[model samples]
Each structure stands twice: as C-alpha cells, then as structure tokens.
Target: MKKLLNYFFQGLLVVIPISVTIVVIYKIIFWIDGLLPFQLPVKLPGIGEVNIPGLGILTIVVGITIFGYFAKFFVANPFFLLLERLLERTPLLKIIYTSVKDLIEAFVGEKKRFNQPVLVTVNKESQVQRIGFITKNDLTEIGISNQKLAVYLPFSYGFNGQLVIVPSENVEKINASGTEMMKFVISGGVTEVD
Candidate 1:
C-alpha cells in the first residue's frame, strides 16, 4: 500500500508540471493570436471561428529560414556590403542593429565558450562541495593570470545564485554524465551513486 502511494505521488509530480507547462504555453499563444488582426477560416462549414495552435513558433521558423537563405548568399557580396555600409552610417539603427546582431551571433555561433562545461571547487574544504561549469577565463595584467577559471554555480532549486573562480588544482574532474550530475543536484544530495 505504501509503495503504491509513493508511485502515485511520483506520477503526479511528473504529470502536473508537464500539464501546467503545456497549458501556460497554449494560453500565451492564444493571447498573442488575439493581438494579431489575421484570422483563419472556420474548419467546419458553419463554425464561428477556428484557430491554429503553435502558429507563432511556425512563423519564427519560416522567418529564420528565409533570413538564413538570404544571409548565406548576400553576406560577402559587394551589393550587400554597400547596403551594410549605409546602415552603419545611421546612428540609432546602427547601435540597435549591432547589438541585436551580436547577441544573435553569440547565441548561435560556434565559438560560444560559455556553454562548455567544466568542473570547479565550490568551498574551501573539498568534502562539502558542488558541481559548477566554467563561464570565463581571466587573463589580466593587474590581477590573476590567463589560467584562472570563472565558474557559475547553479542553485538546487533553479538558476544561478553564486559565481566564483577557483584554481585548477582545487577542482576534481568527475567522470559522471551531466544529466546524472543534474539529478544529484536537483535532489539536494538525496540521490547519489557509489
């Protein structure tokens, strides 16, 4: 009886979050669809209104595909270069364009180093420590050399609350998978493998 109760509660934990996420996403899409003046014709002959779900996501995909197709051929062409020069001459548009372009490139670029994971020490004593990933490496004349690693320590509940840099020797690289490590952290040390 106790085992069955535990299984029921575990199923509830999984189902509730997934259902809530889908409902929230659907509501947001409905709200955005309300903002647009466009409407799809009713599916049935006499139906009043019919709306498609996830149209916003489809629109984003189509836009990105078109932009990528254009960018691939025009990025290095002389005509496109001239247009880019003209756009850069504008003060306000130049700033906004550069900012957005850089942000998108950082998100989609191959050289983005922040997503690369690395192990780091959290506290002074090695016994009580947590897993973290490297965010940046500092190489400065006044302070630490180029060898220092900055790590972002994520909290158990969600997201990050602490950031620190530890020397290379203090960190012990583990052979566990990232998903396994995340499970350990999310369980607040209740789950671990020998």
Candidate 2:
C-alpha cells in the first residue's frame, strides 16, 4: 500500500506540471489571438467557441511569416529605415525595443555560446567539489587575466540557487554532458551516471 501511494504521488508530480504548462500555453495563445485584428469565423461542428483546431498555432505561424517577410524587405527600404529611425528617437519605446531586441538576439543569435560545465571545489576542503560552467575568459589591460565560471549549487527538488564565478584553475573539466548534469541537479545528486 505504501509503495502504491508513492507511485501515485510520483505520477501526480509529473502529470500536474505537464497539464498546467499546456493550459498556460493555450491561454497565452488564445489571448494573443483575441488581440489580433481578424480571426477565422468558422467554428468546429462540436466545439462552438473554440474556433478551428490548432488555430492558435496557425495564427502564430502566420504572424511570424508576415513579420519575417516585412523585416526582410522593409527594414532595408529607405522609407521604413526613416520610420525606424523616428521610432528609435522616442525615449520610452526605444528603451523597450532595445532591451527586447537584445534579449531576443541573445537567445537566438548564432554568435552566442553558453557556459561550459566543469567540476570545482566548493568548501574549504578540496574534497567537497561542485559542478560549474565556464562563462568566459576576461583579458584586462591591467595585466590581470581571469576566467569566469558559473556554478549551479542545487537545493531541494528544484534549482533554487546562485551562479558563482570562480577562477579557471580552481575548476576541473568533467566528461559529462549538460543534460546529465541537469538530471543530477534535479534529483539532488541522487541520480548518478556510470
């Protein structure tokens, strides 16, 4: 009976999060579609107000396609360039646009490379070691060179931690992938790879 209860609880843990995530995504898409100027009037035979199946996804696809088309052509065009310059001059909108553009570029840009994970000693004793990801190597004109590493110290069932930057020499490269490290972190070091 105890074993069955444990399994049921574990199942609920997985299923609840998945269902919640799907519902949240659906609601967001529905809200965005509501804001659009036009929408398909044809409703499904069974579902009265749900519109067509996967219409939200279709709307997103169409919106992205239109945006891409406009960006490719209009961005370089003289008239559009003038409008863009005018918009950029606006203080409030410019700040918002610049911040959003930077965030988007960071996520989707080809030049962006993520920190590589390595093993580092955490506490006073070298015996206590933790996993860290190398952010970058900073070469300053002050004749001081330093390597930045982000260490994720996991706590509880989820990651509620800070990223610590340590020197390069303090860390040792582990022959493990990011996925394996994530699993280890999520399970609070209970999950180990042979």
Candidate 3:
C-alpha cells in the first residue's frame, strides 16, 4: 500500500504541472485567436477562403512588430505622448496607469528591468540574504537616493511580492536568468532552474 501510494503521488507530480501548462497555453492561444475579425479571412492553399484558426495570433504578431519598429525609432511617438498627457491629468488614473505600464515594460520592453537577478543582504551581520529582481537600478530617476537600487522580491508558491530599495553595495548580482529565477521563486525551490 505504501509503495502504491508513493508511485501514485510521484505520477501526479509529473502529470499535474505538464497538464496545467499545456491547458493554459492552449487557452491563451485561443483567447488571442478570438481577437481577430472572425468573419473575414484570406484564402489559403489547402483551406480555401476559410477563416482559419490562429489568424488572430498572426495578425497580432505582425501588428506588434510594426508598432515596435516605429516605437524603437521614434522613442516618443505623438500618439503615446497624447495618451500620456491625458493620463497624467487624471490623478487616480495616472497612478494606476503608470504602475501598470512600468510593470509591463519591466517584463517585456526595451528596459527589461527584471533580467538582472541579485542577492540582497537583508541582515549584514547575520549574513541573511534574499534573491530579488532589480526593478530599478537608478533611484535618482524617481528623485530618490542615488545609493539605493529598487528590487522586487517574489513570494514562494504565490503571486504576492515585495518591492524594496536597498543600497547598491549590498546587492550582489546573480548569474541566473530571469526566467529561471522566477520559476525557482514561484515554485518555492521545489522545481529545478532548468
């Protein structure tokens, strides 16, 4: 009975994560695919003039590529400037919008803030350290202390996180990639950083 239960548990551990990952990817693909003009589609070689699946995704990829090209060269487009000015006027909206935008940019923008993982010393005398992502390397941009760098520490096995600013000297940059570090943090070290 003990061996049988152990095997069952091991099997579950292998199956559940793989199943969830596949299911989530499938759902996300379909959700993005649903964003297209479902009624209109171009004719394909084998499919004829049918509204093929993943057309929406292809459209989005192309649209993003064009947008990125413009944004990279322009730096500050007129449309984006107008939107920023509009958001800044609204007190509540500005705060929410800026925070969300910064978060998104950190993850997938030119800045790529979270790519640098660090070991921050929380207790110097005790030598206590924590792993974190460097969200902001220069606090002076926000008119904060120049000696400090902002880091985001994620909770293990949870979505919760803490944002802190520590002295740059206390942070030792790690060799791990952002994706590997995030996986380790989220899995509470239960999963390997492969």
Candidate 4:
C-alpha cells in the first residue's frame, strides 16, 4: 500500500502540471475565439467554401506570439524566479518540478540544449553507434574532464533517455537538424532523415 501511494504521488507529480497546462491552453483558446467578432469564408481549390475560424485562430496565435515576446523580454524572468523560489521550499516537489521544467526547456526554451546532434561510438569493438545530442560540451564545471562531453541518448518511442559521458573524440557531429534527428531517434530509426 505504501508503494502504491508512492506511485500515486509520482504520477500526480508528473501528470498534474501537464494536465493543468493543457486545460489552461484549451480554455484560453476558446475564450479568445469567443471574443472575435468576424468569420471569413473562403473558396478552396477543390472543395466548396469552408468557414475557417480564421481571424480568431490567427489572433490567438499572434497574441500568444506577442505574449511570448513580452514574457521573454520583461515578464518571464522574474515570474519564473519567484516560482522556482516557491517550489524550492518543497523538497520532493522541487525535484520533480525542476526536472520537468528543465526537460521542457531543453527542447523549446531560449537556450536549446539538444541542438547539437551527434553519433556516439558506444561500443568500439562492435562498431556500434548511438544517436544523441551533446547537452554539455564541457563537463569541467562538474569536475568531469574537459575531454568528455554529456550526451543525451533518447529512447525509442519515449520521452525519457539516458545521459552518458563520452570522450569528445568518440562523438561525431551529425549533419542532420535537431528536429530530424530527434524524430529519427524517437521513431527507433524507422523514420527517414530529410
């Protein structure tokens, strides 16, 4: 029963924030859509005229973009600082929150950590290589040798991954874009890189 309760808390820690975010975004989209006064119907190439919630969607999208700009320029820093301070007061919650936050930020934040995709030689004897992103090129700050790098090897069909410290010489930078490489890795190499 204790183990089950532990699992429940872990699930809540992961699910609640994501669920709340989705719900909030859903509410915001519909609320803004309701405020828009006009709908433009346009003729398509093949099909008849279709009513696109054109301006409402556009307004929401543009509004979100502008909001993001302002958030980055003026609001987000202080807001997140305060939020992180509050989260730090709680022990377990702080770990979960920061981990999830950093993971999200790694992909979409201003400081994208997964941009440098590379092929890591995991087993030299078998000539086995794994696709990963170089998250930290210099691990010296963490007392790791500067000759090693931190590579994040994403698992197939999952958001979770393993981080490995490999010698810089064994890491080969790939020509593919981050998104393409991520897609290929997540699809278990089934997806073609374009």
* Number of the top-ranking candidate, with lDDT as the measure: 4
TM-score of 2: 0.55
Candidate 4 global CA lDDT score: 0.88
RMSD, model 3, all Cα superposed? 4.2
Each model's backbone clash number: 0, 0, 0, 0
Off by over 4 Å in 1: 1-7, 31-44, 77-107, 126-128, 141-143, 156-163, 174-194
Writing each residue's lDDT as its tens digit, candidate 4 over 60-169 gives 78988998888778755877778779897789998998888888899899879999999999999999999999998888899999999999999998988999999999
Question: Which stretches of candidate 2 lie above 4 Å from their native place?
Answer: 43-50, 53-57, 111-194
Instruction: Score every model by TM-score.
Output: 0.61, 0.55, 0.69, 0.61
- Deviation from native of the Cα of residue 184 in model 1, angstroms: 7.2
Better of 2 and 3 by lDDT: 3
lDDT of 3 by residue, 67-96 (tens): 888878875878888988999889999999
- Candidate 1's error at 59, in angstroms? 1.0
- Candidates 2 and 4, the one with greater lDDT: 4
User: What is the Å distance of residue 123 in model 4 from its true position?
Assistant: 1.1
Q: Write the per-residue lDDT of candidate 2 for residues 80-143, one digit (tens) a residue.
A: 7887787688999899877676546533654332335577777656578876555445535435
Higher TM-score: candidate 2 or 3? 3
| Per-model RMSD to reference | 5.1, 5.4, 4.2, 14.5
| Better-scoring candidate (TM-score), 1 or 3 | 3
Candidate 3 C-alpha error for residue 64, in Å: 4.6
